[model samples]
Target: MEVVQVLCMKGGNGDTSYAQNSLLQKKVISLTKPITDEAISNLFCNNFPARLCIADLGCSSGPNTLFAVLEFVTTVDKVHKKMGHELPEIQVFLNDLPGNDFNTIFKSLPTFQKDLQKTMGAGAESCFVTGVPGSFYGRLFLGKSLHFVHSSYSLQWLSQVPRGLESNKGNIYMASSSPPSVLKAYYEQFQTDFSMFLRCRSEELLEGGSMVLTFLGRISEDPSSKECCYIWELLAVALNDMVAEGLVEEEKMDSFNIPQYTPSPAEVKCEVEKEGSFTINRLEASEVNWNAYHEEVFSRYQKIVADRMSREKTEFVNVTVSMTKRG
Candidate 1:
């Protein structure tokens, strides 16, 4: 699939919109708050930039988008105030695919600004927020412009679905049923895309800049582990059932696959090492349980997910990594 052209969270503030269904992502932002705080704090302390430029990559629209930016700003404000330094003029960029709900984010700016003013008092006046629409796998900012970068619940999405996966039929992702070739293609795609991401960010980040990233991951070395792929697997099962009922085309289902990969910590470390632009400051994994299940309101697909999750008590593995650009 053409991810940039097609990939976007459901827009606007409706019941089915991403803005409403993104509680999980909000939890993820909170989950990695400490890491993000430290990254911003360290960057500010090392070299106080009078004008601080920060980017939240894959910053899908909603409260969660600005939540991250607010956290970074809050951290810098606290650190600088503690050190008795003047507050910096904060230039904030929210980045995502061209199809992202930038309009929703823009419309909500008044409230975000008010909240900022309420939280930071006079210091909030110096903050400027803007949206940059593009894929982060390529350059999105000027060279050496950003000091601290943050991405949460993103980057597990690949630039595109892996090539040569015709044999990966019946499964939408790297599942246990997938053949060796399918798994290999997925891993290779992740390595390529992640390395490119690091390279682009390195060019945009100032010397000694920091990045804190959180995304779906696995604790196992196995590429087809259930922790990473079960969600997709269950999704595939629903799709297959639809195919069986003639509600969807089998050919279309067979041709489709999710353009995402959940890398193990070792895989992430290896790619970062191979890219050779940044040093890993910290890498940690945590498990988060699936949210409470409600059977009364669920559709067939939701029921499938809820039922399996209830039975297995499956938890998603989140990997958060902190990195610093070398001088």
Candidate 2:
């Protein structure tokens, strides 16, 4: 099956305010640290080699990716320092969709390298950071190569928008109410994409490697209620307004759907268990209200809410960390 390369045109034009919301950044880094530390510590303690290979799947083009990579490496360096051992050389592979704005990522690398040198000192250790564009559902590295994998805010997107929406069966993703058929299609796509993810990673990760994943998720099983994400509602309203203004075609609005699948925490755990290769180490869920007023190009179409209660109350993104010990 061909994978749909996940692309976000919304942030490609250099309007990074939406992508760099302070609350969103704090929540993402807070949720990721424990998992990242665990994975790095496990890999280092295993005594695999003098060099470590770590990858961030679905790493979009921005300073956020650079921040995350540096955070992980800094943690690893600290661990090595505590052990009274020389810091190991690290190679960070940044993987994203083929259509990603690699120019932006590449332009920021030199600055990152300088920051690394200033913080860790020139003689501490060497670290290589490079971008590799591709779908995560395929092999991006050699077998038994990677020691750790990390992804955030990117797993909820399916390989593609679900097929067969025109048959009147149902739409796969809904802004408000969802039909049973739509729910079924969403679940099936998740299962397929997630299974392919496991199969691909199983080959790329070494026997004692680890992976950390975080994404938007639903806390309830009800298909009709607003339990998933508020961004969907906001986007739906924006699309509707555009359609009414003739800025976008009506049929295109009907056919156009955001590629998303907000699986429940239990459902995610079940799928991971069934894969049988990775063992869950920790899972946690939290919510963050990522709304701030910014007089930027992207924040021009702002909506005023009466209170926090009206901003669509849904569970925060879910984070899961897992490990695989080569059997």
Candidate 3:
């Protein structure tokens, strides 16, 4: 599929002050720590560098991104303290799409620095955090320069829309009664994106470094289920309504498609194993009831659509996959 970059108007500022704090972000961060600690301990125990370089890929501008990175660093600090060793100088790189709202990220940095200073202490080793904007499929750091990499709520986005859909063979994502074409397109994109991710990370990670990623996913191969996700349906309804109202052309709606894709747990594991560089230490899939937060966020989403779109839609459900990586 020819990848089409849909230019979407920026919606929210990535803040959740008014949204319900289901603590989903906190839980994911907490779950991420033990895996990170284990990997770092194993990779750097004997050859702990004075400085540790880490990258958080697909780090959207928000408290969630900051929270996850802080939790990981704090955990590492505790591990070093328990071992009677001084904490390594930490350097964290936050990465996301080029269009991401960097102002929001930058504004939060002072608070992040203050908390870090308090937790690790002013006399403790220094830790530097900076934002790097780009796609993860490409190079973002110097070769063999990083000790660890982490990404959350990212990677499920296809690098581009799948091709061959005009012929009815189906592409990476489409609105249809049956979703086989959608599934195939998603699988192909994942295969490409996963390969690029490995190739890029391999170039930047030390010989024994590790990576951890969390993303939305599915447990079953069935594509036409409510469990699969309802975002497609909601979008279809919204688009149809807009077409009926002559807000957007019918042809434009036909060409537009969702940029997201959700892989099954088995499919993800297969790709990781096939990559040959990463040793899979853990692969877990779980149902995440974001209902509380969904209720709050979707309400806001509906209002946004109502102003621009012709209809309102319901909340969509999503599954989550957490994976650990080792070189």
Highest lDDT scorer: 1
Residue range 1-327, candidate 3, lDDT tens digits: 333233222424534441124256556656556666676666556676888898988776667767777776887788777778777788889987777766777888889888877887863347778889778878999999988888766777777766545432221144355346655765687789878888889889887778877666666676444444555554456556666788767776666666666766677778777877777776776555433223433554465445533443333233333333443
TM-score of each: 0.97, 0.86, 0.81
Clashes of each: 0, 0, 2
Taking the tens digit of each residue's C-alpha lDDT, what string does model 1 give over 65-183?
A: 88878888888889999999999999999999999989999998899889899889999999999999999999999999998898888899999989999999898889999999999
Clashing pairs in 1: none
By TM-score, how accurate is candidate 1?
0.97
Indicate the TM-score of model 2.
Answer: 0.86
Candidate numbers sorted by lDDT from highest down: 1, 2, 3
Per-residue lDDT, model 2, residue 32, is: 66
Q: Compute the lDDT of residue 63 as modeled in candidate 3.
A: 71
Name the regions of candidate 2 deviating beyond 4 angstroms: 1-6, 9-13, 16-26, 123-125, 167-172, 223-225, 241-247, 292-301, 304-315
Highest TM-score among the candidates is held by which one? Answer: 1
| Cα error, candidate 1, residue 288 (Å) | 1.1
Better of 1 and 2 by lDDT: 1
